[model samples]
Target: MGFIIKLLLTGAAAMLAAYVLPGVSIDGFLTALILALVLAVLNAIVRPILVFLTIPVTILTLGLFLLVINAVIILLADYLIAGFAVDGFIWALLFSLVLSVITAILDMIF
Candidate 1:
């Protein structure tokens, strides 16, 4: 199914990002898949609420604050998932950015 393919792509991107970033690490492919799923769920549920609450700051920052929100979501995933570790907030921010770029590339290719 298309959904399954998308998840696999996301997992691959997560693994690749972790491999590229020393500050982030994922145990294995399965953990990457789980991480992808958790991120999707968090983005679906928590992200909107966060965006809504942070509207003023987001507006003030000209939408750049979304990057911080993305990093916070990554940190939340780090806390919720085992076998996945991000060294710090800066690492989380970098990882989120890398993951987004990798995922975008993968999506384009597939």
Candidate 2:
């Protein structure tokens, strides 16, 4: 299914992020897959609500607050997933940004 494909792509992106970012790490392929699934669920259920609630700040920051939201989601995932780790807030932000770029590229290529 399309969802499965996206999930796999996201897992791949997570692994890619681990490789490219020093402060981000995934323990294994399975952990990456799990992280990807959790991230998808959180983004679907939590991210929209956060975005809606932060609209004022988002507008004030010219939409940059969305990146912070993405980082928060990543940090939440890091907290929930034992095998996934982000060094700190800065690493979370960079990881989120890199993961987005990697996933977008994967989406395009696949």
Candidate 3:
């Protein structure tokens, strides 16, 4: 199914991103898959509420605040998932950005 394929791509991207960034680490592909699922759930449930609440700041920053929200989601994932860790906020931000890029490329290819 398309959803399963996307999840697999996200897991692959997470693995690649963790490999590329010293500050990010994943135990294995299984853990990467778990991470991908957790991220998707958080993005679906938590992200919209955060975005709505932060609209004023988001507008003031010209949408840059979304990056912070993304990092927060990553940090939350780090907290919720075992075998996955991000060193700090900066690392979370970088990891999120790298993961996005890798996922986009994978999506394009597949």
- What TM-score should be assigned to candidate 3? 0.99
Pitting candidate 1 against candidate 3, the one with the higher TM-score is: 3
Candidate 2 stretches with Cα past 4 Å from truth are none
Q: Write the per-residue lDDT of candidate 2 for residues 1-110, one digit (tens) a residue.
A: 99999999999999999999999989999999999999999999999999999999999999999999999999999999999999999999999989899999988899
Among all windows of ten consecutive residues in candidate 2, which has the lowest summed lDDT?
99-108
- Model 3 agreement with the true structure over 1-110: per-residue lDDT tens digits: 99999999999999999999999999999999999999999999999999999999999999999999999999999999999999999999999999999999999999
Q: Itemize residue pairs with steric clashes in candidate 3.
A: none
- TM-score, prediction 2: 0.97
- Rank order (by lDDT, best first): 3, 1, 2
CA displacement after TM-score superposition, residue 109 of candidate 1 (Å): 0.5
lDDT of 1 by residue, 9-89 (tens): 999999999999999999999999999999999999999999999999999999999999999999999999999999999
Question: Model 1, stretches more than 4 Å misplaced?
Answer: none
RMSD in order of candidates: 0.5, 0.7, 0.4
Q: What value does the lDDT take at residue 40 in candidate 2?
A: 91
